[model samples]
Each structure stands twice: as C-alpha cells, then as structure tokens.
Target: MKWSEFKIHTTNEAIEPVSNILHEAGASGVVIEDRNDLDKDWSTMYGTIYELDPENYPEEGVYIKAYLPVNSFLGETVEEIKQAINNLETFDIDIGHNKVTISEINEEEWATAWKKYYKPVKISDKITITPTWEDYQPVSSDEIIIELDPGMAFGTGTHPTTVLSLQALERYIQTGDSVMDVGSGSGVLSIGAILLGAADVQAFDLDEVAVKSTTINVKLNKVQDRVTTRQNDLLKDIDVQADVIVSNILAEIIVKTTQEAYQLIKPGGYFITSGIINAKKELVKQDLEKQGFNIVETNQMEDWISIIAQKPE
Candidate 1:
C-alpha cells in the first residue's frame, strides 16, 4: 500500500494541463494548491488547507500534487517522472532533482488514519455533509444527507468552486428537470441537485474516487433512484440531454468542455459554471457567447466566480 508522491512545481497557468496529462497517464489523485499552502503543516490536521468545497475563495494559484502507485516507478520511476515533468511547455516548473519521495504503507491503516482529519461540512443552509465518524443532526429529518469521510474525492462542499456550484444549483433545480453535473466530485452537486428538486440527475467525473464517492453519497442521501453517477468526462460519454449542466472545474477545462455542456442542454436549458478564477471571467464569457449561451448572471465570492448561463431557444 505504498504510494509515490510526485510534487511538481509548475507555473500557475500550466497546472490544469499537467493534471490532465497525469490523469490520462493513470495517476490516482491529482491536487492543485497555492505555493503559500506549502508552509502550512497538516500532519495533525488535514495537511491541506482550503477545503475542496469550491464555495470559499475567489481566485488562487499554487503547486500540483499527483500521487501514483509505487509500482508505477519500481525502477527509474523518478527519472520517468522527471522526464514527464520536464516535457510540459505549458508553464514554468522546478524539481529538487532527488526530491521525489516514495514510501510504502498499509492501505487500510493509512486510510483509517487520514479519516481522522475529516469533519462534518455544511454546504448550504439546507445541505450538510457529515462524515460517518462524526455526530450531526440534520436540520430536518430529510433535508439533506451526505455521509462520507473525506479522502481524495472532491466535494466536501467546502471549496469555493463547489460551494458556488451548489449555490447555483439551488436557484434553478426544479422538481422534474433532468440535470447533469459534469465533474461531479463526491457527487455533491448531483446530490444537491437531487435534494434541491431535480427528479433525474446524472453526474460524471474523471476520477474513480469521484465515481465511487458519488455512488456512496447517493446511497447516503437515499437518492439512488434519482441521482445517477457516471464515469465520463464532460459529456463525451453521457448520452442523455439535461435541463441543467453544471461544471465546477478549472477555466481551461471549462473552455474545452463548453461545447459539450452546451450540447447536453436542451434548448434554453441552463449551464452553471464555477471553479473559475476572477481573471478568467472574460474567457469563459467569450466561450459561452460563441456557443450561443447568453450569460444570465455571475456571482463572485472572494476571487472566484460562478456564472449562470442559458442555452438559447
């Protein structure tokens, strides 16, 4: 159960592309964090700052963390990693030459140990995610339920991107609307979408944790019949059309997936996007406009923005 931790220092701009490449290359979990976060030690705490809720900050940048199985680098793994790291022309990057760390662990022991860092998270006024190990009482017997221990999946509903995405979901979900949550981490948005009123919700994430978390969360919320989590990217493999399409991911991925989001929507359907840095507002706006989505409104919390757009009739 040993893991190889690959820390790559890349220009803030190249973080997403690098993550995508590694993800395609079969990395387990990839995380991006600000350089300033490195100073914070979470050995006793969560070792990571800024929850993945996506509803907290406005804009930020940092280093990327990608973890791979130890066997992936049995021999010369460091060298292979270095070569992969150096090949990226998307941004500036640095390495300590021998800074790569490879360590073994008892998977169960490590997983259990990390669960201590998890706590219950409140995503919105009506939605609450409590880890199985914590004590929490729902505002209502059935208002919302997301029983999960945070691991490497997204959506404790703590990050600005996720928070904003869920907030946007609150405004538009109707009792019978078919909804799609692209990059649905931990199935938070999908779960929220279902709780909010959407009858049939379909979600997708590129990560296995996301897929697994979404399934686990659906059961936790008792919405298995309404919310369906799929393993797909954008709408590349999801064939169903939806009334609402939500994406809480980086701007570059947003741009790349814009068309698919548009296609997923029925005429005049809605598209809600968060996980956008304030600086990239225009880039997203332009992409939406080009694809015939009229920007209805944009909400910003801290430096992050969540925009709501409508597919034209």
Candidate 2:
C-alpha cells in the first residue's frame, strides 16, 4: 500500500492546533520535528535516552508530519487541512511559515518507523508516559505509568501542554474526586486523572476521531470503568459538576467556556487550562478571573503556559 507523508512547516506556537487539524483530517500518525528539541537539556532521572539527528530537523520553524493513506479523497483532505490551519489565525495564533508539502512512501516504511520518536519519559513527579511497545518498569514503588499508542491518537501525552496538565492534576486531584477533561485528546488527561486517584472522569472532545481515540486509550489504561468518553463541544449544554475541570486546548476556545466551566465546577473546585501560548496567557487569565475564578497557579514549560484557577468556596 502507498501512503502520503503530509508535512507542514509552522511555528512552535502553532504545533498543537496544526497537529490537531491533521488528526481531524484522518492522518494515521503525526510526527513533530522541532529544531529547538536538539538544544533541549534532557534529564537522565528517568534513564530515558535521546538519540536525535540534526538532519531530520528544519533550520527555522517546526515540521509537523502525518501519514495519510493514498486514496481518491486525499487531495480534498489535504486542502481542508491547509484551510483549517489557515483559519487558526482568526484566533490570533501565528501560523509561521505555513508552507506545506507532500511525498509518497510505502506503508511498510512508516507503519513502525514513527514509533522510534516515542519512548518512556517521566513527564511529571509521579507520571511517566511510555509507548505500548516499550518494555518499561517502575523504578520507584510510587511511580505511575501510562501506556499510550500514539498511532491511534493525536499525541503521545508528552507535549508541554499535556505535561503541565498532568502536573496540575497531580497537585490538585483528590483521591475520590471527579474530573471533567475537555478537549480530551487521546484521553490522556482523563486517564492520568484516574491513575492519580480520581474516582471517575468525564472525557469530552469535539472531534469524533478524538472521541474514539479517547475511548480506546481509556480501555488500554484499564480505566474504562472510571472514565467515560463523550462527543461534545467544550462544555456545551453540560450540567454535571466535577471536583476539577481540565482543558488542554487553545486559549481562545478556553475563554469561550469560562462561564460554563465556572457553573459546572463545584465551589472550591479548580479549572485547569493549558495549550496556551505565552502571548495569550493574559487572555485566559483575565477571562477566568472575570468568571469569578481565583488564579491559584501559573506554570510554563517552554513557550506553553498552564493556568490553574479555583472557584471560591
């Protein structure tokens, strides 16, 4: 079988949304090659080894690559993806170079090759996300492991936005609390909440592919009973109250749901928002505050920011 390698040259700030566009367009797997990664100071605490090659990276902006099966509708899908990414600018997101290219490849080449880009990495104090194919064991008795098959989802759960969300969950999630995960890509945040001691989680995503991916990941993590996957726009017409509401999506989308999120969260509960670029941090912060939330913590990993806000008791 033949496959098309669709690649986009875009800024780091645009990575989350562009990758999301590709996934929604039916891409099999997404690979991000950022030039900045070569200069990252990886920690050896988790014994995770890095073997990066400079040749694979672009000199300026990041490269977002995805695999799509060569079919009759391939051209239309690519055009839709391009338009979707261009539409991101209305939300104030910089699309950077915005150059897109495509190449043909054999199925045998990419089926397993993308797996090499993922491995076990301790993203937070207690949680370590590893691909399903790797043989990884806990180095500490209290360490938590999350196994993800990125081929079936949008991300491997190692992105900075996700890491910040997991870290916030580790800090705020009570043992028996309920969590609502908006924009639950890969269901990573929902599964992470369950593993971190939340009794139950409600995972919602606007995309059907994301909904399916979340369901599969929930089962893979053996948290099926504790997590429920639903297809819904962010907090639209949702009435359930949760101890914590976490969303790792665009800041513009996050602001639109501030009122709904505030009403849905129980008093003293928290709203954790991520996938916010540095420039838009103030926008989310102001929106949350206007909705009566008290900013409890703000954290940054690289260029992304995660804001943790709480409802007053």
Query: Against the unseen true structure, what C-alpha lDDT does each candidate score?
Result: 0.68, 0.91
Worst 10 residues of 1 by lDDT: 91-100
- In the range 54-142, model 1's lDDT, one tens digit per residue, is 33212344445555666744456556655676665343232223133444545554445335435665556666667666777766765
Report the Cα lDDT for candidate 1: 0.68
Model 2 — which ten-residue stretch has the worst lDDT?
A: 41-50
**What CA RMSD would candidate 2 show?**
1.3
Error of 1 at 282 (Å): 0.7
What TM-score, to 2 decimals, does candidate 2 have? Answer: 0.97
* Model 2 residue pairs with clashes: none
Name model 1 segments beyond 4 Å from true: 1-109, 140-143, 206-209, 237-239
